[model samples]
Target: MNASRRDLLKLGTLAAAGSFLPAAALANAGSGVIEKAAKPLRILILGGTGFTGPFQVNYALARGHKVTLFNRGKRPSPEWPGEVEQLHGDRNTGDLKSLEGREWDVCIDNPTSLPFWVRDAGKVLAGKVGHYLFISTISVYADGSKPGMTEDAKLAEYKGKDAMAETMETLRADIENLYGALKALSEAEAHKQFGDQVTIVRPGYIVGPRDETDRFTYWPKRIAQGGEVLVPGDGLDPVQIIDGRDLGEWMIRLAEKGTRGTFNAVGPDYELTMDSMLHGCHAVTGGKVTFTHFPVADIPEDVGLPIWVPREGTPFSGYGAVSNAKAIAEGLTFRPLATTVTELLTWYRALPAERQAEVRAGIPLDKEAELLKAFHAKQGA
Candidate 1:
């Protein structure tokens, strides 16, 4: 199954009633920032309806910039600000035919994972936009197994012969195997056109409100229910995640500063363990639950654990620990994990009964119970 399939389901459901989310339930109200740019520029967002794209649009609008969205108009975001300009044309079919002669001070590409998409957009926006920011991921790195890796780290190379195929079917077929290589190739396509004008943002797991993945949000919702929660690896394993809201704001800032080159954008700026993250969730939501930490090996191979990367031998070896020095030095900051958990729970709870029926990541209740039984039996033996 596509790991991000559920992320697409929640794309249109911005369940929050308004801009203000419940903060009283949260223990920490992260360092809030309202940016007032030195000079606002017109910004174009290639994909504004998905996970982090709306946040980017909202932050750009808040920072006083004109925002235009380019997509096929399949998923319309009703929650977006009313002023967003929409241009409809499929990059795969039209090669950005709708964007000809259009110009923006900066263009943000949040949905382009295919090099063909980048090449198509580049053909149109080459001289029109002053800055081109491509949203890449830490997955682009050749080896995430090594901790403290930075932007200069080795990148994954596309194994496929054709780097320009832009079909969702192609993505679905090769995601598990070639996703990283393709993403790195896409980043290269952006650079091929814009050179120094490109700003590559390699973010780790992006979580927070408006995130449909339920990858990180799984903890907040699960803990709030309160029970014998099955946890992995003694709960001391460090995990790294960057909030979508924080990233959205930082993108606008980077564009305003006209930043160029690659940056590893992931962090809370320090070490954060699984237990500390769960504590924040429990404290914020008042979940009266007891966690049973099991050895990583105890976790059944079939049971999926969200956010807890296995340690023995995995491609995501350094997943819990990656460096963000370059991005931090350029003014990237993070909100407390508490604030993220609280708001996420608040939003998840507000969803309709049907919307909250299933989560995309993490073990299901039935699987957890079975795994816990075996785990305890082994301990007794």
Candidate 2:
């Protein structure tokens, strides 16, 4: 049940900010309470059942905002703390008819990869909503080799024949190249449709509860098992991750304040290294473990390692170094890494036994042992 090589690469590339850790933010990490807005506002979320959607819904409800979700209604609804109206529609077939003539104070578009979704939504909710917020990714940037890349860096260009004609299936057919380009196009389309009132928040490596990818979760779960763990690099490479709740809550705050412009929503408020990240997870789990380090070149290409992208010589090396100062300036905050680990484990454990048995991501034990044996033999020789 080991994760595929593609999965590892996708997680490493697709998934930072800030230096000062907020005490109040840490205190409220596990709570359902937040500062209420000056006045209640109507909020519309395009997708509500995915990883970050639920957090946004829960936090918006906690802040006393009226919330509405528009989706296909395939997944069961979460036990929301307050009343939330659900509108059923599919963005694939251009079926946003349910959203026609609806008005809200703000609209948060999640789970949008195709540009046509934005175009179609604009057809319905154009002037009806006061503000539009789009959830984007750090991957939209063209270059990740330069450290400290900001929101103004060059964006990837869609090399395909026509951006508007691309679909999920076409993007999946060539994800590595198309995903970033298409997302960049989607951002432009958002600004085009929503005008200057649009807010673009690009986050990297969003890890927390309800995460089906298990990229960041793999480290905590593997380290908790207590044994020789395979770690990539010398442990000095920078690493940046934002909790789902932190990102979700900040988006709501931006909507409340009508914050505009693009921001790199990456973080711990300070710099973190791979060594520090793993040790932090172990500190919380109290797992008896030893980490064995290997150079990136020593590892087999097919054996995928999650959340350990090389700090040098790769296009995505800057992923761990992307700036989040813009987000921090806009009241963006992060929970401690330990808090994320604890809550993630709690959520994973509470899942059904059958679900827990499936290995979501990481190197299999047998493969790890084999790699370790070969590595040690080379060292001895």
Candidate 3:
């Protein structure tokens, strides 16, 4: 279903990007589209109030499935249906007593990065659940430099003989370095206990509304500001992203049919490039904007840019080129990139001033300005 949008300044962009957005997939949007609805089943979600989790819960409820959320009461979900049951426990500390002996038709593991979280929950949920769906990342892949990599590609490995078990603090300390490797470990734990009943989804660069991190949100925010935006590489570099809502909806369908195995959940529904992504943002923002391009070699390695990894001479050269054919064949559909841009701008503008100022990804405004100056100067020199 298409996410609802607000503050409609310009929608003409949707027409130009229509070719990129498939209308056949969304043929039932805005209308109650769950045909011959499957019998309602109970769905359990770990960390339901978080960014991606809410979308899963939202779509699950919309599809007539009941939801139960497991998390610390620290973040309550007022946006969700009031009738959904919620249980409290801390997964980091391995306190899963709240989930003991409880059963559901399916369980969606949304927040697990550490292996112990899965092992701890599996001990309790082993035969009690029908299917276990774990939300994972494309980061789990060992290499992205090779194009056309599929779901069966090499995965990042963690040594089994290592003496110490990974903890949240340890993962947090070197998150950028260890995240993928650890997610690989966690995926193993899910299957070790559940076997064929486990479904794993590996998404590339999850984006769109309610995204706390500025990773992909930076483009929409920067473009809407209407000025010289500093973008890395020539505008043709490859890029890939999946809206969080799209991924959530697909997972619901998977759970409904008891589909299992791995799928790469990245899309434009077609191949996409850096220029198309930026121009899509500009089209929706309706701004007198200019994108200043910098060569990949010019930007310092530590000055992290969001979403645009260089596709040459780096470990992530093929990052944006990961395949999604399997997922699409299995009914995984994507809304147009224009819909993502429009909905993201609407969501970002709704935030309070303080929260809006707290974007966690992308370069800061001053740093972006400094880089743009040096980029232009080098060209003039």
Ranking by TM-score: 2, 1, 3
Q: If both were scored by TM-score, which would come out higher, candidate 2 or candidate 3?
A: 2
Task: Report lDDT (CA) for all predictions.
Answer: 0.75, 0.80, 0.74
Error of 1 at 190 (Å): 0.7
Q: Which stretches of candidate 1 lie above 4 Å from their native place?
A: 1-35
Task: Give the alpha carbon lDDT tens digit for every residue of 1-381 in model 2.
Answer: 122324422432233111122222232465655677788889999987677777788778778899999999887677677889999999999999889877999999988878998989988888989999998888888887778999999998888898889888987788878887888888898888888879998888888776767788889988999899988878898888888778888898898888999999888799899899999999999957999987677787677777766777876778888889989999998888988999888777776778667776678888888988899999999
| Model 3 C-alpha lDDT per residue in residues 1-381, reported as the tens digit of each score | 000011000101001111112222222243355543368889999876666676667677767889999998785454554368989999877788989978999999887778888988888899999999998777778876776789999898775444137786776565656677788888888999888899999887777776666677888888888778887778787888888778878888899998999998888688789888999888888869888877776777557677775666666677778888999999998888888878777667777778779856677888888888887888899
lDDT of 1 by residue, 1-381 (tens): 212322221222221222233222221235445556779899999977666677777777767788999988887454544388988889767557779988999999987677888888888899999999988877777786667788888988777767775465786576755667778888888988887899999887787876666778788888888889988877777777888778877888899999988888888898888898888788897847999987776665556666665443565767667788889999998988877887777777787777688766787888888888988888899
Model 2 CA deviation exceeding 4 Å by range: 1-33
Ten residues in sequence with the least summed lDDT for candidate 1: 8-17
Candidate 3 global TM-score = 0.88
Q: For each candidate, what TM-score against the reference? A: 0.90, 0.93, 0.88
1 against 2, candidate with superior lDDT: 2
Worst 10 residues of 2 by lDDT: 16-25
Error of 2 at 218 (Å): 0.4
Best by TM-score: 2
